[model samples]
Target: PFTPVEHDTTQEVYTLLHSMSHALVSTASDQCGLATESISEMIMPAIPAIVLYAKSAEHFALGGMATLFETRIHPWVDHTIDYTEQCLLDPPCSRDETGAACHACLHLNTVSCESMNEYLDRRRLVGGYDSTPFWDI
Candidate 1:
């Protein structure tokens, strides 16, 4: 039940999901009182989903994420959608030969991203250059 073409497609989907996860984490940091580096991501491309979790050793748990999910989830998601609509590093970032991703946009710190900040594209989240946005789909 495997094919090379399907594998490529899966990787692309994973990148999209991963980028979206980082976007949410960054937005959560801004709105939820959690540090960007304190959040981590788990991407399940098969399920086409990502999970953002708090990973901090300095405390037993950070209540910010809990509070966000419990009360501010809707606004949190709205903010993430709005945030990804544009990047401070856009234009150059969007047309970069390295593919539309950069630290200023969809990247997370090494401690937060298990992928070493690779395989990300902001276009995957916002749509550009003919790629339909994940949110749109």
Candidate 2:
């Protein structure tokens, strides 16, 4: 069986060094434009250094809802696995699941999980999937 592992300072140093290597990668990042904000969750693109950020005090996007949930505007999430499962359980989705999968932000603008799944499919068409997901939480 796989043994549980703990992260220590020495291990952290290695992790940093490894990240510096060419083989390491970065996921979707929305630091585009100028504003600076924290990211909680995102579906990473195949390209490196792609992280999606939440809305700034200035501007926002249609995907704003998802970002908000990631940052958890008020208190933190209740830490339930059900919520996470709900995000990936979109029904009647497409077969071409090559791109970004669904990211279960607490407030993804979608009215339902099904919609969120479809959105992820759309992202796949536009941005190819990356092995490393952009998880800001």
lDDT of each: 0.81, 0.28
Model 1 scores worst on lDDT over the 10 consecutive residues at 1-10
Model 1 error, position 85 (Å): 1.7
Tens digit of lDDT per residue, candidate 2, span 1-137? 22222445433332222222101111112212222223323322223222333444434542554554466433322222222223343442222353223343222333222123232322212222442222221
Leading candidate by lDDT? 1
Decoy 1 TM-score against native: 0.87
Quality of model 1 by C-alpha lDDT: 0.81
lDDT of 1 at 106: 84
Tell me the TM-score of model 2. Answer: 0.21
* Deviation of model 1 at 87, angstroms: 1.7
True-vs-predicted CA distance for residue 105, candidate 2, Å:
8.4
